[model samples]
Target: MTEKQFKKLKYYVIAITILFVVGFLLWEHLNGGILSHHLMHHSDYPSISNWWGLLILPFLAWLSTVRIEKRVTLQPDDAPVKAKILRVVLIGFFGMLVLSLVQSLSFSVGYESVAICLSLGLVVVGLFLPIYRAECIFGYVFGSIFFTGAIIPLIGILVIAGISWFSHVCIKPLVFRVIRAQPQ
Candidate 1:
């Protein structure tokens, strides 16, 4: 969608993210996941969330335009393997979601640039907004924005590209290798 539309969309996504995170912390605080399985085993780091982070993968995959034509499952494996792939994808997605939020917030709040950076998300949002016709407006809301200068947007673009490339190079191939190989 347009830049104005993108800003509106980003705001909505940010709002939801705030609400979800706040509610989660509140819920966990009340429930005592202060020390839980997700806290211990699922975390990539000592300070992180595992629930939505783990499941945000498929949503993330859908969030991006991986291939223009060919579509393949992340890992070539059975149910269990696929499940594991999903988990890894979710963690990876968490990283992206978190970074996007940080970058979005930073650009909106702390940026001093005077340039606009267009994101691939804008294209996707525009396309989807017409196809899905408002049903998927929420997706566009978090698509991407041009809140900062060219440099910040470039930084975001590089960060996203770097993360995706690094994950593909290190994480995906390794996981797929294990999953794709035949058992002895």
Candidate 2:
């Protein structure tokens, strides 16, 4: 996309994010405050309001869009790869949204195992695709914000990002050096 188009897209995303926050606030107000779970239980800590999303979501949106624009500008020729990444991000966003909805709405089903599996899967993906940190975090928090709230997912992503960075910056080079040192 051209710079002009990216600017327009950024505006649209900002507008939508604002609308979403307003809608969520209204919904929460209408049906009492939305309570956030701590460590997968509502009673483990004092009731935390979902109002945190109002600030966090917009920040994530801005950060992700800026990162995406920079990536597109730096490698304009990688349009196909960029498109694939976009598709994957969108899929992940919606998939997480659905999962969060289900886990929040249903009290009978055990989804802890599923969540653990998905988290592990994302860690593996992040090790290989460390360049999409902003996109991954944005998609994850945006998708799960309604049910999981903002802070928990933000903390989780920060930990994952750190591990991914360590693997990419430290371990990968060490492994490459070891491989090169071995006689064929």
Candidate 3:
């Protein structure tokens, strides 16, 4: 996509994110705050308002757009990569949203083991797809904010992102070097 098209897309994403958060807050208000209920009752997981999503999600949208824009500008010829990144971002957002909703709803119905597996599955996916840390982190936290709240998931994603980064940046190259040095 051209720079003009990318700019338009960025604005659209920001607008949609803001509108979604506003609509969610309104729905929560109308429902007497049912959406903001603490999904996990453990003492370690402090009760945080789903309203935090109002700020967090939009901020993530803006930040991701800016970061992607910088990357696209730096490699103007890499249109295929730009499109791939956009696809990954959209997939991550919707995929994680669906996963988080399923996990949260299942847990609410007492399927605690399913929820645990889903959460662990996310970590495993991150390990395997280490290059998409930013997209995954953004999507995971954005999807999680309503059901699981923001702070805890944000913390969890950060930890996962760190490990993914370490593996991607440090370990992967070392392994490649070792493999290349070995006899065929």
The candidate that achieves the highest lDDT relative to the unseen native structure: 3
* Per-residue lDDT of 24 in model 3: 76
Give lDDT: candidate 3, residue 113. 96
On TM-score, who's better, 2 or 3?
3
Q: Point to the candidate with the largest TM-score.
A: 3
Residue pair clashes in candidate 1? 1-126, 9-141
Displacement of residue 87 (Cα, Å) in model 2 is: 5.0
Error of 2 at 32 (Å): 2.8
Clashing pairs in 3: none
TM-score of each: 0.30, 0.79, 0.83
Rank by lDDT, highest first: 3, 2, 1
lDDT of 1 at 1: 31
Model 1 lDDT per residue over 20-128, tens place:
5455546655886532222222356343333432234233333432320111244453567655644544444444345445545654574423112334453333332
Report clashes for each candidate as comma-separated counts. Answer: 2, 0, 0
Give all candidates' CA lDDT scores: 0.39, 0.72, 0.74
TM-score of 2: 0.79
Residue 138: error of model 3 in Å? 2.2
Model 3 deviation from the true structure expressed as Cα RMSD, one decimal place: 2.6
lDDT of 1 at 173: 74
**Cα lDDT of model 1 overall?**
0.39
